[model samples]
Target: MTYLVNNPADFVDESIDGFVAANSNLVRRVPGGVVRATRTPPGQVAVVIGGGSGHYPAFAGLVGQGLAHGAAMGNVFASPSAQQIYSVAKAAASDSGVLLSFGNYAGDVLNFGIAEERLKAEGIPCRCFAVTDDICSGPADKASERRGIAGDLTVFRAAALAAAEGKSLDEVYEFASHANDRTRSFGVAFSGCTLPGASQPLFTVPKGRMGVGMGIHGEQGIEEVDMPSASDLADMLVDRLLDERPDGAASPRVGVMLNGLGSVKYEELFVLYKRVSERLEAAGLTLVQPEVGELVTSFEMAGVSLTLFWLDDALEQAWTAPATTPAYCRGGVALEGEPRDDADLAAAHEEETPDASEDSKSDAAGMLAVIETIQAKIEAEAEDLGKLDAISGDGDHGIGMDTGARAALSAARRAVEKGCGAGTVLMRAGDAWANEAGGTSGALWGLGLRSVGACIGDENSVAAPVVAEGVVEATDAIMRLGGAEIGDKTMLDSMKPFSDKLAEEVKAGTPLRQAWRRAAEASQQAADATANLAPKKGRAKNHSDKSIGHADPGAISFAMIVSAVADTLESLHEDAA
Candidate 1:
């Protein structure tokens, strides 16, 4: 458990602040995450890598001279929002282009993929790739479906080295992909990690036993076995990795990283490494600069991951290149770049309010009330939501939703105070939720609100039919962005039912308030029904069997929000009457 923390809600942000303070010479704080304090050369590809916080050296610590140019840090065990990724990429971008890379996780895929598209739409050359190195996550034939683990270091390093050599975005992406393809990681844990303010660990291993194939995000392993000696454990890790070596490999040399997942100290790691080295040498493999310490860690998880990065001639060259970051360093790096100017950073700007009719402005106030209701509901139900998610995921859903809803309410209030229309208010609120929440649910909710806002223009009064249309638009936007259908056991399972019912009622000339109430009921039913279905997406999909009896946290949260909105709408109607 984490001992030092002010507010659990503010842990990620405060941690980032302290990290930037300590590494001032190596990194500078950006809006979303951190960037190298020194500027990159003109026309050099900017290598941006990131994921959730708690993995210290992985993200911010690697931002310096010859590694990641920037990292879009997110909440603990959550993907960074699209807005955050876009901001970090823009800040680190050079004349050449930006190359985005991260672990092959659902939230990261959704958020980073959106950011990549946004960059290209703005005419900035950009490409994104996900590292799939955890051999335990998927079958070898479906290697791309594997989650990234400690092997992220090799992929990030290779990309950064290519970028430092002034390669184009395409070349940088190629190098990262090659590194990912050649890398394999396998992990085990003696115990699970606890989030800040949590009373217990996310999961637990039995006494005198260890979990095999455990995930870094506090997920229980696929199997459990009696604890083995250090030498026996080393053989288990090294042999499993050796069996899954990349196909068509041309070299006997490999870059090894025996990464400690938080609580395991260097001494323990070195002991394990001794046996690991012997096993590799026995298998006729040569080790190159084996790293045996904390690299990519989960918050105080008593675990370790072994990564074998198969090195070809090209990869070996990049692997041996010089680097200087806060936590990890290679050979010697010449410091030639000047410090970046604060003013040159991409800072947030105040948005100008657009003209709107009195009716639209009044409706914007109503929208603010609904958002307030959502914020309250999410806060009240956060613990329950997290419990549901913990059954199959990292168990941060409740915290993420609470953070997002609060941000949305704050943004909606500000927009209404500025005399913005209902459309602009919802859009701003959506942006805030997406930016602050920084996960799969956050991105989808943000997109849904923005879509609804866009469908209901500021120039027109919002009627029952128009509201129904907006909801449909929102549902469509989520489906498009998330690529999930109604039965996928996501929020879409509830959202689709609510949207369709609302549209049906509106088409039948039902009152807006009455239609919304009915739709909210439908949403609740759908959410409850998800308990009978297995998850088809997100982290939960990995442990689908475990989630069979529990409703999806995303679906439950959606139901709660819509029901709260219905209550808020009824109250407003009663007051007006």
Candidate 2:
């Protein structure tokens, strides 16, 4: 179902109003969807930035005390009109002159250039910095002609800071050009975004696929490819960046950003970062600083963009300068460094020393038995979850979860047999899960399992009280890492309450078997309660109504499988007795 906006025709105006309202201390709109920071005094060389509204931080959110002086906003993915650009320029221009900056697109070039000429006629000096950084957006020979993506942040920030620092308009223009020269971006879309108040998507992508090099606004990409693991995607993006080699040093100071479209989860972003880091290191690139989040997004789109800025002292200083905006802000100079040495890498890759207890055949067998059961359950449910997911959300959830669980199970068995602690097993399993599984849910599941394994550690056996405490602790760990709290209609809603209940029962001196049974029941009840919860976070949040009546599949399956595991644990205890 489509969203019920006040009016489709006035959507851009209304959105701009809300943005100004929320950031009144920093921004105000001039005529035409153009906004300027309240602090920007007229007559200082002004920096005008813009393109579209949906990529929040892109055009407007980057306007702040130390950033752009103004932004011209367009509807959804459309380029801002020529009039909008002129208005913003007029509003921001001072005796010093004005610089118009935007992504390099045909529409933007035409409109902004028109505005530039108009500003000249008005006796206001103006220059333009049209950013083009996406390697996937164009061929190698014409890579500099590709569409702008996240790399615009670095370029714009450099120009804005220079202007704020009292640079002449010419100087600011040059500064921005240099920054653009050092920046490169690439992106992949799992699914497309939707226009406001629209039921259908703005574009379509096939299931279990990704449009590599897709533009932020649903433009056609270099090619559609089968979805790959985070590592694979990272490798592809990094390889492209390295191949193109943004202007400057053999080993440039790099700023990396794994930017999500509006609806991607933090968990998935982290997984992407983890792989990106590895690939960057292998390529002999130094990571100066990194940003990961939904900074620039298409409305409710499922995708990610990787932006790399080859840095210099000037660019580095500007990026670190404090500026508060709606969706983009950073403070303090970020200390930067290169990847670790080969010795460190080798040390990390070395085989682990075995634990004494794990040398026993029975202990190894027991661990295998537990993991095998978990693996079987995941394999069995994979198809069922996929079918359920097909109706409302991306159908990858089921496949992703199953893949994650199986990976975790495999890692756990191997670690345990190799005489590693449960904590080690969990950490290793988490890595495997993230590497093997696709989509957001896999990352969440991997994180949760890792936390649980860390809490359990090397414990061979636990009393009811310890088990209860461990479960509660695991829940807390998940909350911290995933950044999702209980009752957010996430997996934690079901897992946390049930674990707490288990602790309560154990504290009452209930038998391990009985406490587990109670926890299982609590888990089931909590999962059911999620059916009434409006999703306030994650992938499901996009469809507020669709998620309202249905239990979050992640929560449901987590509760069910955990409850079953607890049941098995109880049975094992009974058999031992």
Candidate 3:
């Protein structure tokens, strides 16, 4: 239970503020996250790493000399938005390219991949890689699908060290990839973690039982079993990792990290590490500079993970490299570089608002009202949505939606105040939603809104045909960007139906308000129908059986938004009459 919290919505932001204040000597706050205070070498590749916020010491704490140049921090247990990643990369980038790395989670993959493409399009070299080292997340043959856990340290270190050595972008990427392939981690939780302001933990373990193969983000474990003694638990962890040793590993030496998830004390870890060391030595493997403490953590989770980094010659050299950061440090660091100039660290600025026709400005005001209505709907249903998502996912969907909708409303209001057009208002709102929400749904919704905005330009009055066209554009953009089909049990399940119904009604000359109401009805039906589906993508895919009776949170939220918009339109018509 997290006791110290003001507004749960502002927790991540406030925490980052305090973190930057305390670590100002080693790091400085950037727009999206934190960057190293010292300047990198002129031609060195910038190793930018990140993920959700709760996993402290992992992201911001790792930014310094011989480690990550920057970290794009996100919402708690949510991946950073593409805009956030782009901002961090731009701030940290030098003459050389940037290397983006993070855990192998769906949200992180989507957001980071988008950022990577954006950087390349802007003529900045960038490459993104996800660490897949958790042995129990997927079958051995499907190693790429495994979730990254405590083993992230090994891969991040290898890449950052190579970058600090002035290696090229390709070299840094190769090192990170190779490290990921050679690393393996396994963990178990005695109890689950509670998110800030939440009344209950995400998941619970029965008395005398332990959840095995647990994720750091409060994801339920794959299996539950009787709690074992410390010695037996160490053997269990050591044996699992040893069995999955990477092929072609000729070295007997390995780097070991016995990581505490959150609440586990250092004394307990040392006890476990003693048995772990004995087990590894007895198995004829040598441990080099083994770390036994909190590294990658889940906010107050009572769990531990064991990570083994099988080291070849190159990997060992990189592993031994010196580093100094807020939470982690190696042997003596020189601190030889000059402090980064404040001008060089300026955040990316929002674009200037464009002029709008009077009619378009009137439409913008209506859009603002619609956005406000959506925000209200999301806030009202957030708890129920989160409960639904917790059936198979991490249970943050409701909070994420509420956060995004509020941000969108704020941005829409600002755009309207500036006398912007409907298109500009929607586009600005979308950007704000993505930047603040920072997750898969955030990225997709942002893309969809931006697409609609592109179809309805600032100069034109929005009509039924134009609105239907914008819906089609939005649907197409979501499908293209998310790579999820209609039946994938995502927001598309509702969005596609809504788009199709609205287009058909408009083609038959239906009034815009009536057609939109009909479309919202169709969306609701589609969202409900998703209860019969087994998710084929995202985090729910890992627990498809558990999701069978629950509609996807994304689909439900989309339906809610459209229905709310329909009601808003009707209210406006009534007021005018």
- In the order shown, the candidates' Cα RMSDs to the true structure are 2.6, 22.5, 2.9
Q: What is the C-alpha lDDT of each candidate?
A: 0.88, 0.70, 0.89
TM-score of each: 0.93, 0.56, 0.92
Q: Which portions of model 1 show Cα errors greater than 4 Å? A: 464-466, 503-511, 569-577
Q: Write the per-residue lDDT of candidate 2 for residues 1-577, one digit (tens) a residue.
A: 2275888757778888887788765666665554444535544688888886788767788776667777887656655655567767766677888899888764466556656766798798899778988776557677555678888888888997888788888999999988888888888888887777767675678998888777776564557899898889888877877777854544557888889987779999999899899888777778876898877787778888888888778888877777766666677322211222323212123448445333233333443455566667778887887765544454545766676678777887777767775456655676556435523454455545555555555545434664566678767755654556677887888888788888888888888778877887888899989888886554345455767778877787777677667645632323221
lDDT of 2: 0.70
Candidate 1 accuracy as lDDT: 0.88
**What are the clash counts of all predictions, listed in order?**
0, 2, 0
- Which residue runs of candidate 3 sit more than 4 Å off their true CA positions? 463-469, 500-518, 567-577
Q: What tens-digit string does per-residue lDDT give for candidate 3 at 520-554? A: 99999999999999998888887999999889999
Number of the top-ranking candidate, with TM-score as the measure: 1
